[model samples]
Target: MDSDSHPAAAPADDKTWEELVKNVLRAEMMRRGVSYAALAERLAAFGITDNELNLRNKVSRGRFTAVFLMQVLKALEVEWVHVPASIDDAARKGGAQALAASKRQP
Candidate 1:
């Protein structure tokens, strides 16, 4: 994915980490113009058979494992991923705020 298309970086803190991972995958999908069906098809070639509905649910929850992440990345042809050694204070503060706001909801 192009660097410009990335959402502002944030720390995958205790609460917001799942969302961060989910957004990263979703952004990559969006960048490749990959639909759930297309992803399902690609995975099928590797003997994985997650249907569109399952894939959608999995991506939305963002609670999948590292193996799942790799499978999706491989299927999507992601060459590499970056990991920030540290997140800046502003981004961490924003992530914390977002996580708190989410928990206070009905």
Candidate 2:
């Protein structure tokens, strides 16, 4: 009876959510002109040890956790978050495919 179990429910794959979060993080980094090394340095000051390689791989693959996302945003001094009002149909299609694939497995 869960809403997500319904036939018409949209895809909510981890990959999709990760990509969504990664996109937001990248945009914020760009806006602040914060390079990987610089961001790492900022985080280090707060006792985090993220380096350029970790940042590159993590963000590029969009496989990081929500806590990491919040840390990055905090290091960037981002006081607000925003979700785009529109998304491309192509992205939605991809998410749906991923969701279907996930459901087919055990």
Best prediction by lDDT? 1
Whole-structure CA lDDT of model 1: 0.69
**Clash number for every model?**
0, 0
Give each model a TM-score: 0.66, 0.68
Give all candidates' CA lDDT scores: 0.69, 0.67
- Per-residue CA lDDT of candidate 1, range 3-105, in tens? 6686556655644666656666775676678988999999999899999999999987879999999999999998865432333431343433333233221
Predicted candidate 2 versus true structure: per-residue lDDT over 36-105, tens digit per residue = 8899998998899978999988887878778888888899998876554332322343432333233221
Where does model 1 exceed 4 Å of error? Answer: 1-13, 83-106
At residue 17, candidate 2 shows an lDDT of 59
Model 2: residues >4 Å from true position, as ranges? 1-12, 89-106
